[model samples]
Target: MKIQHFTNQLHLLKEDESTTRKGAFIVLSAICLVGCLTFVSLAVDIGYINLVKTRMQNAVDAAALAAAQEITNAVNTAPVGTADVTQYSRDQARIAAKDVASLNDVFIDKQIDVIFGRRSFNESTQEFDVTWNASPSNVVKVIARRDNNDTSAQDGKLKLFFAGVTGDRYSTIVAQAVAYVESRDIVVVHDFSRSMNFDSYFNNESSARLSDSQIEQNLELVWNDLQMPNTGSLAFTPQYLTTTKSDYGVSATVTFKYDDLEVTSAGEIEKVQVKYTDNSYQTFNGLSGNSVNINGSKNIETAWVTARGPSENEPVTVTNNGISVTYAANRKSATMSSPQRIRELYVGFTDNSTDYRSYGSNGPYNASYSSWKEMDYMYLEVLDGRSYWYYFNAPNGGNEVTLQFDDSNWEVKQAFGLTGSYPYPRGSWDGFINHARNYSEFSSRGFRETYGGLTLMNYILRDYPGHWETPDLWKTRHFPFHAIKEGHLLLCDFLEDLGFDDHLGMVSYDTSHRQEKTMYDSDPNVPSVNISSEPITDNYQAIRDLMQYKQAAHYSYATNMGGGLEDGIQMILDNSRAGARRTILLMTDGNTNTMDSGASSSLPHGWDWDELFDYDGDGNSDYYTNSSQRRYVLRTAYDAVQNGITVHTMSVGIDADRNLMRAIAHLAGGHFIDVPGGASVADMESEVEQAFHRIASFVPPAKLMNQD
Candidate 1:
């Protein structure tokens, strides 16, 4: 009976123990399942949250940059002093940020804050600060936030499955970013019109006139004004002839023909014709003649005489009875009761064959002299009457003389008026010496100063192999500045050596404005551009080609400073290049002669000239003077500064308005480089190139404020 009772109790105890074990197992399994679910939720949901946060950060960053860019665009496009906080909010930046922020399923709880203020980097503290609401805000900042309280961002809140069991429903996330407008896009406004031909020293075209005079003076110095004769002396011993009267009581008349004049090989007078009319005249060559009448003149005698020269080739011939030659002379002279009268004289050039080069055959005098070695300069006098002298330069001699004559009759012909200006001075020592001295000095000084800027620029930009051989010395010595002489520069080859990659563009203006080159192609409609609005490339060769071939426009003598500034500013007002700093290199070598017309109907987007600079209050076409142009430049610069565009001014020569350039630089918050007036064209080129380098090397002081 006891054994049976103990077994029943054991069985009951076993049943209770089984029940306790089952309950404990069930409780532990429930806890394990709950813990596993919590771990899975933490891994997957937390990963997703982290990813969302990354995307949100990117969105905010983009938002900040967009906002900053909008401010820049506003400043660039709006008229000077017209950009405000309202314009910033209305710009594409705010809209761009909002769109980007929503890309990652993150939405802002409220409108993004677009703040325009000053952003500065503190060197002492090594920190950046952005002060909000600063007047004339040049920096743009954007702040974006999201929480569950905002319906738009609530969908992106961290949703937890197991974490809810821990009494947590969702996790809130927020992201913020800031960006400051910086200047990067640059437009180099260069003067390439005809007037750039003006000198760096003087202000107007008067200098060019002086240059021309100097050229003429130098030419004279080289050829005409020499103190010493370039060619050998022309001095020659003269010969004399005396004709004695055979009959002292009777008077005699003489007639000399043009055919009898002769010259020796040494350019000395050798033979001359003499005639006398007298019964007592005696001839030296045994010839006798009665009273001769010439051209209706009675009582005329004739004789052919030879002067005593080194060569005794011919004998003297004279009429006999009335006159006799006591002694032979180069020129014939007669001692007669009646004085002799010269009716005419002739001069000509002879060929090597001693044949006359007739005036008809020889062409002009200078032409005849070039072909023939010998020329006869003749002189004649009518006793106690007017004397006449000339250089007879005729091809077939002259067809007619003072007396009836022909080319074949005589080699000599009377020359009437043959004096004129000469390429090289000749004749008297006074005129020749004066011109020769002046020409010599002028040649030493070199030719006229180079005037055309395009020509000079082409020389400066040429490639040279010698530059690389000694690169260090080339740069240190500023070789380009020193190497220019007579418009040639040895430093031209160094342009390729510079190897710079800065984005470059050009704007040329005179009476009108034209976009020469741009970082981005803005004019696709123009036939030259096949692709519309194509991004600018880094092709230095192409850039150089544009500069070399197409930089300068036609000569419009007018200078429109306001128009150029407006166009240059337009080049940097691009939204695609936002977040990059904008700059304008305004280089001018002259004053203003025209002004911008506030007409936007004929312009493209970003080409609103009136919006950029309004010189006259009338709001119509108005001409700007020097003073008004300066005001316009300053006003444009002010607008650029407010829009974060730095404008650097380079007054290449004296004519470039100095004070205006300084003011523009000051107001635009850009570096002012005075390549300062008074440099030669070559020197201006060197300094201008150096100024470009300075601008390229310049690092804008910390454009980003509080950058992380």
Candidate 2:
């Protein structure tokens, strides 16, 4: 019985052991499966988090950049000190950010916060700070952080898919930018003509009638406001004064005098005065006398002595005590005597009033009174309405005007002329008028007017910013390459503003004149050749030399054979290497006929006969002859263009050869412009500006690099 019980127990134990092993294996397998699932979950979750972070960062960056760009644009467009500019900037930033987000197909989960502040560097803190929360936040806290900062690593942030996995987690982004005031130095040149200075009829009687005091006052005002550098202070320098007169027969003279007088006794005194009987009187003072005489008799009296005269055909004579003294008139000469020693004498006779008139070498006669009046205390009159007269005391012996005889009881009064017409020469004034007319004609025909009213200095000033820094301020008798280099990039001035036209006129007028000449030369009947052609050879090359020289020539000419060609090519290459893409602006009148190299052509053979006849030949010519020289120019230009340069051509004038200009422009990958050639320089400058702006707009901003 005992043996049978033990065997049953062993069997049971074996079964129990097997059951335990199986249970353990099942538990282990369950643990492994669970661990694998957890690992997979973590990987998926992290990947989603990363994707959200990237999208948020990208959105923030785009928004920041857009906002910055908006600020820049608004600042550029708004006038200084305008209150609305800040608002406009904010609005632009909001719109730009919104647009950027929309383009990226992302939605901003939170409001964007934008803040603007002035950039400040704190020495004590050793940190740079920009004001934040200064502007209204539209999406998030737009913390403007420096690019160097760690916290601002991400420009902006958007909460996207990561919230589900990271428990509503958010990211921070900061934008960094630089802002500073930009300034450009400018030079301004203006014409300083009498007409520009004051409103006055051209040599009208009214203009001539202005008094010396009035003229002096007007001139002083103009001088004070002259806008010269270092003026208005006590240390200011006076400008050199020059005068030109209208009359050819009348001599021009200017005199400066200083007066020093003292009052001895306030009383009426008889004075002996000297007189020059021919020339106009200049001045007198109480210093020198031959003798004291009265009416050619020997006498001494307490008289006020006066001296005067550029006498009328007689010598200057002094009489005292029955004795007479005479002196010949000399240029820049004078005499003097004491005021109490001689009688006052007026060399030229005055009618009833103090006004003196020219008697035309006849006799003492009356003449028409001028509108100008002389002060009673003044010892001067306007003779012939042009010349001046003066009175002075002979006793002082110096050139001086004295106020010794003041009729103390006489009140200051103005003198006027009667309305009745006076005898006057009909055509005597015509000569003066004709001279004025001729002056206007010559001035108009000169380069000052012909080049669309552009002065050489004006062109330099307008075109170049660095021109002002040149040692000579770009002022040279001859065209200088230094000036051209200084101003070449200043083509901005030619752009158009709201009210200004383009600068096309400047190029047009010059080109048109050249075209006409070329056309005339091609004609067979016209003078075949001329000596003027000698200077015309290699003109274009000369121009290139002038543009590239260290000490450049003023006149533009063609380049010379070796160095000139090398220099021009190098210039273009250097500019390109430096990332300054060049755009050539060729202005022509469309007639491009030029001489063939080594061809047996006459002096003017390069000109177009057909065009010349068109200009003045009354439809006698059948076919139009083209310009070979112009074609050469075009080919040369095209070669440059094909080698990575762009060329734009403008044809001005009615006779512009559109076909040729269009072909050149097309080959060079540029547009052709046609406009009136006679436009003003200001207009031409505007046109050039416009073309540049147009070209610039099409170019990608990434290609632009600042050179200055």
Candidate 3:
């Protein structure tokens, strides 16, 4: 009975304990289920909020960028020199931003916040600041957001998931951005050195234009005024003739004929050379002429005169020893021009000896020397002036030389040009020496204080550039300024592309852009022709006009980059618009230099002055070069920086002052353009145009700005 009672009590106690364990397990399982559901809700809500936030940021950035692009388009298409940042421009930008922002997916369509303002840099803080305004805005600010207070246009906050949420059921997100276009004012400065045309070539047409009288004028200027010293000279002794037929054919005589002059060709006899069958010949070089002594190893062989000029005029004639010369039958005219020559009478060339052209077989003859007495003459011939530098003027340069002819042979003297008994002071080139002589543009550059004698043409007729000016230099047509001018025009086109307000003006310099006097202010009896202009301007045509009809005519022919930069700076100070970025593009091709300004002018007074100056006009005075000139230039660059101008420098060739240009660019906060030299004019020109475009690209593009 006692054992049964104890077992029943124990079993009852075990049953109660088991029931308690079951209830506890149910409560713990329910809690774990609730915790897992809560974690999933948190993840979904957090991820959705993050995705919405990212989308919002992208929307605003894209909207701001789109708006900025709209403004840029307006600026580019509008006529240049118009009002900047107009209301219509800003309005269009805002519309673009709103349209771009609205397409984005938030909870719903959001109302974007758009604002216009001017953005500028703060010097004190070294940061950009935006000034909000209704007009003249350069910047656009955009804000994209969710959870707007205005329920009608709100992009509602992100909704919570997992069927329900207790508090704060939605999350708001926002993004913002700013973008702008820059306004700028720019100028181009030129280094107008004579050497600027050194590597240039005749790129213009030389055809029907030849028919026009302009051809003659062009020839004169190209062969004279803009002439550059390129060829060296050899010792020459001119041969004289007592009669037109004397002295030239001293041995075995040979006849000569010149190539015909044609509407299409500027032809002349390059040489009247005589050769023997052994190929031995008399060299008739400097100031070439007719009739040569062709005694071959003393054995007379076939001899002929070679007419040379343009390749179009090349023709060969063959004859045994005694050659009867005849001009080509086909000719433009048989007109004997003043100071006649063999080339002047025949108007065309011929290759067919059988069907040859003709016009006065032996060609234009100089006037008759039938008169008996001796007479003096002065024939302007282009002579290489280096040898006579110390003798003439000590070096303002030129090739237009006139000689005091004293060939005792009366016949020869009359055949050339010897009029009445006109007397120039009895001396060779200079009646007396001029210590400081004026020539061409250097009239005011140096004063003639001392006098002496310089016999430039004690002997007449010397060939310069070898072929004389008849047509050698004309055919080569090396005009570098043409390429330079084209480059300038392209820059103007780019300015047109930038839509006007960017503005452009130019000033050229060598010593100074100031043409206070005429280029060849050659006459001292008259007042110097004064030239001046506002430092800068937006008149595109005016700048182009200034460049037109110009070829390195600066007096002293020295480069003064600082003076040019100074002019540019003044242009900005005097003409640039407020809020416009002032900038300059400085171009050059030389070591920096200038003539001394302290020297005064005296001999430019009368014919007495004429007597004082050497015929070739290179007077005695020194060109000064020192560190001060360099400092002056650098100071100009620094002054540019002080006046809020940036100067980008370009050295046009291998020879340009790269260091100085680089220093100037660096000081004024700009770039240095390189000029890897080239062998052809086309290549050099292409580089110049490309450089202009490169700088054009520097006119700051529309960009995203930091909202901060």
Reference-based lDDT, each prediction: 0.42, 0.32, 0.48
Q: Which ten residues in a row have the lowest lDDT in candidate 1?
A: 409-418
Off by over 4 Å in 1: 1-183, 200-501, 518-532, 535-537, 550-555, 599-626, 702-708
> Which candidate number maximizes lDDT?
3
**Candidate 2 stretches greater than 4 Å from native:** 1-34, 53-98, 102-569, 575-699, 702-708
What is the per-residue lDDT of model 1 for residues 1-708, given as tens digits with 9 covering 90 to 100?
999999999999999999999999999999998988888878767887777678877777776666565544543345656445345444555566566666755565324355556554433763445577764444656555445554445444565555676666576777677666443445667665434533311223424333534322222222222222222221111011112221111113222221121112111222323333333333233222323222312222344333221223222222222212211222122121112333333433333233332333222312111222432222222232334332222112111111111211011111111123222221322332222222332223331111122111112112111222111111211212221111111112222221112244556777677666532222342223211142232333444433332322232446777678787777667421534457777866667656677622132235333543344455542222236555565566666776777888776554567666765675576777776533233445566665665655453442335565
User: What TM-score would every model get versus the actual structure?
Assistant: 0.35, 0.34, 0.43
Best by TM-score: 3
Best-to-worst ranking by TM-score: 3, 1, 2
Give the per-residue lDDT of model 3 (tens digit) for 136-217.
Answer: 5667778766665544555655565652654576666777777776656677887666556444311123221222223333
RMSD of model 3 against the true structure: 20.8
